[model samples]
Target: MTDPAKHAVLYRMVMPEHVCPWGLKARHLLRSKGFTVDDHWLETREANDAFKAEHGVKTTPQVFIDGVRVGGYEDLRRHLGLKAPDPQAKTYGPVLAVFAVTALMALAVSHAAFGSALTFRALEWFIGLSMMALAMLKLQNLETFSTMFLNYDLLAKRWIPYGKVYPFAELGAGALMVAGVLTWLSAPVALFIGGVGAISVFKAVYLDKRELKCACVGGSGNVPLGFLSLTENLMMIAMAVWMGVMALQHG
Candidate 1:
């Protein structure tokens, strides 16, 4: 008696010009799941076309378990009780990745420029890098970002143009802060926007009790619009005030 679970047949495209990645993935998946794969490589375009036509399927990398057809790579994943990866799935991973990388870069740059890593300047660099990274995400798709921003932003709700300019303003302030130059421009912009953002987030989440996504990362982000949003605004405010005080004292 042959066990159906132990055997799989994979029909994948493999040619001189190109090899299908999904086909390779299918083979790997089958092997990982303890299936002995009978891999069939269609060596040419004509062979691939003939196989698809004979099987009455549109695409290659088709799988079969115990002589029962299991369709393509996605179908195989379903058969194995694995959810296909969704690119549009809302997650904080993108924002978290950006912040983590930017923080490391900031620390590295700070260490290189200054003799120590633990300085007020390092904090400024972290904040600046974080802001620039966030702005870059927003600027990727301004239309989508603005729509998300207007959902909870007080100023954006009142003035539609504010959403469009927000990313540019953030980028400018962050750049100036990173350079340790143009405190006059950076401080005021950061102060005003950060204050507004903090109040808006507080009102929306704490007062109104509205549960929403944060646009701090991007339009399609899944980061919650509460503590993280508040923290970002507060950080901006602190940076602005610190820079302002330093500027006054240095004069």
Candidate 2:
């Protein structure tokens, strides 16, 4: 049986090029909460603008309950006793997700190669894969990454080209290390960047007490510049040293 009393009027953008995601979310939320939604689409920019002006609101995807304005998506959420996501909240979700995926990949590779998931090779692969994945993220938008990198990276601040070259170097080093070849080159590359990055992170976050976004996960600007960033660099440094020793022993 449908709840006749629970009715919501939703004004949302539905254009040729773009549809309002929030509006979709609002409708879904309304339906999930046992409300019948009367969806109204502002199909054109002019209509959207006119609706905004008529309603004296800045954004679309407005909702009304029982002929009274419930406001936009966030307001509807609040009206429905739900919490809305804060955009400015600092979260390690991206880094944690990256690490989790890389770790799984490492275990998978180790199992495929050594017939055992729990092996020393898994650790090596985890770090190498993490580096490569992070590098790929930065390479997706080099300019954006570099601009964010300059914020806390001491070397990047001084030498702008280093920021641009960093992703390529990381990718090369990670690929070589993962392949277990050219350790002579990969080890040094990893060590140099890791050393510089560790120092920069330590100075900026701890010494200067600066709260900044880490470029480790590229320029999306979610991960905080702190311990995790330092830990990432330290892992590279340790891996570099370990590989360097192994290379020397074999030679």
Candidate 3:
């Protein structure tokens, strides 16, 4: 048993219909941290409201240590040094999710169009859709994306306006490739940008040994600038070359 001075009091809402998850987490956190928790549950809405009014706080589960209020779950986490300062800290989750969803969509489209799930056409569709999706993320906030891009992009760092135009170029090429039209335009655009992007990413990550977030998905994305970024550029370059060769063969 911990000393009385190390006791934590937690008040959380628990009803037949609703149970506050944060309260449970707070209690667990306190218990894990070797604190003896005096847990109190507010069973009714009126009781919960009254408890909030009494404490001068709006949200549950509130924690108290040594007769001092420690706020809610997030606040408690902060007090315990378990919460990161930035809530939107960098993570590869957004980029991974975008790729996974777009790949599935490409497969579905391929199945519908050519009646085959595993085909070269599916790969083409996947690459095209991935580019468009990534471009869309950048287009969400061009200013932010451009700013982040300028951090490591060699060309963008030199010509500031290139960062602003990059997303549109990617989007245009992706759309054209997906439609199997305007290969003459799409191929050259994809090739040029993809070539530049590959070199920039390689130099920044491998040569200069700079660790930075990728601006591939969006300016605010937490995707790291490394292999995945390189792979994306390589995919674009390969697709452009393939499309150009096919066009020449047919012409």
Report how far off residue 243 is in candidate 3 (Å): 0.9
Better of 1 and 3 by TM-score: 1
Better of 2 and 3 by lDDT: 2
Error of 3 at 105 (Å): 0.6
Would you give me the overall lDDT of model 1?
0.89
Q: Which candidate achieves the best lDDT against the true structure?
A: 2
The residue-level lDDT of candidate 2 at 40 comes to 98
Q: How close is candidate 1 to the true structure, as a TM-score?
A: 0.79
TM-score result, candidate 2: 0.92
Off by over 4 Å in 1: 1-5, 12-21, 40-61, 68-89
Ten contiguous residues with the weakest lDDT in model 2: 1-10
Question: Over 4 Å off in model 3, which ranges?
Answer: 1-60, 63-71, 74-89
* Model 2: lDDT of residue 177: 91
lDDT string for model 3 (1-251, tens) is 45555799999999999999989989988888889999999999999999999989888889998899999998998998896345557667777887899899999999998898888888888899989999999999999999999989999989999999999999999999999999999999999999999999999999999999899988877788888888878989999999999999999
lDDT of 2: 0.93
For all candidates in order, the CA lDDT equals 0.89, 0.93, 0.91
Give one digit per residue, the lDDT tens place, for model 2 in 82-137: 99888988888888888999999999989999999999989999999999999999
